[model samples]
Target: MIKTSIQSSASEIKSAREDFFYEQPGSLPGTLSIEEDAPPPVIVLIDYNETHATRKQVSTPEECIPYLDSKSVSWVDVQGLGNEDILQRLGNVFKLHPLLLEDVVNVPQRPKVEDHENQLVIIARMVIPKEHKIGFYSEQVGFVLGKNYLLTVQEEPEHDCFETVRQRIRQNKGTLRKQQADYLLYTLLDSIIDGFFPVLEDYGEVIEDLEEEVVSKPTRKTLEKIYRVRRDLLTLRRAIWPQRDAINSLIRDGSTQISESVRIYLRDCYDHAVQVLDMVETYRELAAGLMDVYLSAVSNRMNEIMKLLTVISSIFIPLTFIAGVYGMNFNTERSPWNMPELNWYWGYPLCLMAMGAIAALLVVFFWRRGWFENYSTIADDTNNKNYGSKINLLWRRSRR
Candidate 1:
């Protein structure tokens, strides 16, 4: 189950590839490249003015036509991109350009802005932190802003960060009810940019926990987490970099669809995007640094192991030499030197005492040199530090 969930999170964080939804080289400019498994479109129409607001789900795109031309600002949110017939009807209902519709239908178009005479097309990428997980889910959101109407098309209906905006509209909070559709666009974009904060915050906490693990007990799993965090941050970087440019274009370009007041709000959104990009870059660098720390920790561990082995070998070398010298046969009857010692009444006892004394002296020498003390110090340090449970908790949280 853990493996499956991890694979799922990886796929979720990896947004649909552009090549999968790209039109053929000579294909028509207006041709759509929808995925085979795209969810059927779900239409939600929200029309409001200063006095009141009304939101309802519409079964057909034609149902939204009546509110588009009304004096009140209308927001038609189309989620999912499966049904070509309904999507085509939605384009016709809003009188969207062929190329505009194609861009909206494409799953992974780069975040950008295109201004038509009557409508402004803004393409954006939205990311939502996965529930109780380490990664995020990303999708494309296209905005078509007109005089008093805004059309938004999303890749899927399951995950979105606009619930707060919807709730604000429902509760009649703030000046949203009185603003035009362009202001609504600004509000939603602000929400999208703000959504990145929670995801980044999660990564920050994960990195902190990882730092502890890397210092105390760096393992292969810790290395894997570092790589994963770096990868996810890169994904976020790719997402926000283009989005910042798109928002800047919205602010700098002279598009009538966006009012000056709304552009001012968009500038704030652009700043938030820039802030998110900075956080992503900072986290990425820290993760890269963690890789180096992990390598050093592993090398230090190996050095400790080798030191222990060297100490044992040093103590045994003299004892092995003494044993080898005694084991040699000099033919005691033929050589007086060997024969006299061999016949001594206490010879075996004296030989044993000499070997024991030699071993004890060697041990004392090593102790005086602080070699033995280091082993005790290392053991004490390892016993005193206790962060294993915390590391496990972090890993469990990330897995979930």
Candidate 2:
């Protein structure tokens, strides 16, 4: 039953691996297509100054225009892009270029940074670790920065890393209230970059567990797990690699939309992105190595099974020969020489004794060669080592 389950899981993994999504060839650029099941857009406005801060939900894009030109900073956060008409009005409200709107609503533009005449557009990918699970949720976040207002768009409202940033603004925490729109952009971007750490930490723990499983008791499920981890890390790498360059471009290009002080902060964000990329690459390599280890462990297990079968066959070979000789029908009534053993009363007992003696001798020979002892000892050692490490981990966690 266990073997059947393992085979079933292996087949599922193979099927999943063969299924991949790709863009249609020769697709038009700046396409603004939306998913049919996408949720309606949710608009939120946060206007703040050094002395006061206010947050409210806006129903229409034009409602945000009154606060956009104020001396204080305005953050217009749009949570969905289900309605094309609303998104178009939002583009007009912010004076955003058509291509910029397309990029924001397109759901998954690669992470990038573009500087327009008076605005800077940033496309970033954000990841949130799933609750009570071993995977992550990923989405694209687009930012459009203007003189006194900053606009941000997210594909969905269910999962976002910007809650803390919102809280800081609401509570007037730290110097966030005093800084300009550029500073708000930095805070949000920093939050997005830092979010990768927790997700990566989850992957790190999973990899450690898989490492132990692959070494001590690898199964088809273990191979599937390794492949899944590698695939996720690849996705994360794809999201972060272009983001790092986008940040570096923001710093190096010297966009007037981003202040010098904010650029310094962006440099720090760049370092965090680099660290994330490093960890992802390391995990990917480790996952690949774990796959090799799993294959080798399975091969060794098969060899051990074959060795035991061969030993059993070797012990039975002489016993089978002895039985064949005694059971031969060579005309015992006509020729005494051919039927001497068949006519003797003690012949049957002697033949049985001979076969038993031969079996015992072979068993003793195999024992002396240490095959059985070696196999048992190796299994015991592996189990003991795995248990010891698990116990140590529990002890450390308890201490913490």
Best by lDDT: 2
Tens-digit lDDT track for model 2 on 83-103? 989998999989988888887
Task: List TM-score per model, in order.
Answer: 0.85, 0.86
Tell me how far the alpha carbon of residue 248 in candidate 1 is from the true structure, in angstroms, after superposition: 1.3
Error of 1 at 11 (Å): 13
lDDT of 2 at 20: 28
lDDT of 1 by residue, 74-109 (tens): 999999999999999999998988888998888788
Please report, in order, the local distance difference test score of every candidate based on alpha carbons: 0.82, 0.83
Cand. 1 Cα-lDDT: 0.82
| Candidate 1: 10-residue stretch with minimal lDDT | 375-384
In order of listing, the candidates' clash counts read 0, 0
